[model samples]
Target: MAGPSSFAARRKVKGVQLTIMVVGQSGTGRTTFVNTLCEQPLIQHQQPVAPEEAHLESGIRINPVQVELEEDGVRVSLTVVDTPGFGDQIDNEFTFNEIMGYLERQYDDILAEESRIKRNPRFRDNRVHALLYFITPTGHALRELDIELMRRLAPRVNVIPVIGKADSLTPSELHDFKRRVMEDIEYYSIPIYNFPYDAEEDDEDTIQENSELRALMPFAIVGSEEEVEVNGQPVRARRYPWGIVEVDNPQHSDFQRLRTALLQTHLHDVKEITHDFLYETFRSEKLSRSLVGDSMGAGYGAGQDASVNPEDLATQSVRIKEEQLKREEDKLRELELRTQRELAERRQELLAKEELLRSLEARLADAQHSNSSTPLPPSQPQSPIPQQGQPHPVLTPHGGAPTNGLQ
Candidate 1:
């Protein structure tokens, strides 16, 4: 029952690290929620756009802000990753890729670093423990964009759907909207991080607590950075003409519950699931691909997932490097083999041509020798010799009637 403000006296503890990413379209109270949850202005409000530039597409920006908060007297170092201009663009497909790419890149970084021989002691794990996806308060059902994003990103991160600016809806409207959103999530089979509890293994209190929190799927949140006097007591609230909305008031908003869960009671759970389940799945897939000699594409941007243990990351890094080196070695060996074969083939061709020329030259030389040694064309015809009193007829140069040259 301890809220963020009441955590100072609850329990004292050592340091703990928690990182949460807030993703939602602008104007969904994302900035205000962080400030209200931290009891200070942790994030700067985005500057208002001029009418002239309102229609332009501004790309998504992932900004992580670190803040120190004492939850239940335990010093909690929190990192809030804010996705600004996420859904603000007319073509928001890019933003979706940006976010998903960011998640995958963190995993990929660990994938690469895990295979390194030497571990980088200064390496920091920025993998998101939880992704709080704020559902726009349309006072109706879930938007297609909402369903699509949750469906796609759930596989990569722990997506906890929440309704932002719940003050926009009436009690009845909000009830119906939450129901519809959950229904849509279920229908689409989006694997949101519902508070899961194993009834048999978990204690009774744990089972009850998890069940209760699970029912609050898509927690409604109202956030305000302004403080106002409530019954002579200072309280963080939003000043409205109708009434004031207190940020920490359970009757007013679930902001306090979410803040506590994120930084206090369920903090370790989220991180555990991130490292144990989500990252494991990604690791298995990448290893399988690398096993088959396929590149992991360019998903490993300059980011690291918190899910990877430092030692494991270092080991994996070395393995991956060795694999890459082996592949390169294989390529070089093949190239050398090809060059050698080509050189041998060229030499063979030259030898064959030379042999052919030598054969032709020998034939020519034989012909010349034969011609030089050949009997010259007879200058005069050989006179026929009489054989035993037979008159021999000689071929006459001017063909005198060949009467044996006696006529």
Candidate 2:
């Protein structure tokens, strides 16, 4: 967590801030996608945002970039939170703890500068609005680990699963990928899209200005066509070239839907969801502690002034003891079952090994017996069994010794 000075530093920035966190595995094109959101010349004017480029007080790596767009007549501030890639280095409990702790620290940071956050950010200021969860293009399904992580995340985060490297997929293949992911985790109901960023190229008067060079470009000024095999027939699916222009192009209906949902519905819902979870989790912990204290005092004689109070204390004690006994019994049963299962497995393994050993021993003994019993018929005579018209030894053209008749 950062010190008060760091909190003050963030508080100084005033605007309609909507934080959109982009997270994913390494090589999933997170940086490219964020650059797409910027919607400018990516490599030219846009500075590269490495994981460690922008540092915060917390150990977690994140780059904060701003995008200005107008929504409802007012300029909207889109704060893209580009997160570090997850892999062998930035993975496991330590990284996860750092991220969660960073999020926790935000609550304190916000409260300290509540007035500034409320006044400065035109959008709802206090919470994370949405999360863009980037995933490697797995044409199969959403993996179990991804779904589980989604489930455990502070439920308020509106997560949109994105398949990076969409250009590699045909239109039909992209649809299949979406379907498989949906089937795997129905709870990941949030929208999904392919990488929404790419280098924008113009195909205008430059063609007229340099006709010879324009001819050199492959498929220059041609309609987009996708090939697919349908019912044992090769088919070319065509779409207007101009239609595939914007990020999450109109040709990609799913991505368009995703963009709409993110900008409209999910963004608003996340704030309420996150706030509720925070309040409820804190409330539950407080309630549990209060109940435990009351139970302890009642059991001790702190609240035993009245004669009727003893019965109440006794009843409470009995209930607690019964619950504890039941838990112990369950634990004992589980332990016993586990031990029996292990013993049975071990016994089966031992029997298999014993059988294998016996078979090997039998084979070894038979081999030894065969070797001992066999003796070379001492010095077989060189003469062949006589047959009517056969020569005993046949000579070769360049022979030092005669060949056997059999040869």
lDDT of each: 0.84, 0.53
Segments of candidate 2 deviating more than 4 angstroms: 1-15, 41-60, 88-91, 110-126, 154-156, 187-248, 253-255, 264-266, 276-407
- How well does candidate 1 match the true structure in TM-score terms? 0.69
Clashing pairs in 2: 15-121, 16-122
lDDT of 2 by residue, 198-227 (tens): 234534443343342222211111112234
What's the residue-level lDDT of 325 in candidate 1?
A: 89
Question: What's the C-alpha lDDT at position 296 in model 1?
Answer: 30
lDDT of 1 by residue, 1-407 (tens): 87975685554668788888999998998998888888888899999889998778878999999998877668888899999988876777888898989998988887777778677997777888899999999977888889889888998889998899999888788889889998888998999999888888989998887887887778989987777999999988889899998888887778877877788778999989988999987886566444333333556333434444656656665686688789879979999999999999999999999999999999999999998997767588876667996677755778655665565
Clashes of each: 10, 2
Best by lDDT: 1
Candidate 1: stretches off by over 4 Å: 1-12, 294-407
RMSD of each: 23.0, 29.5
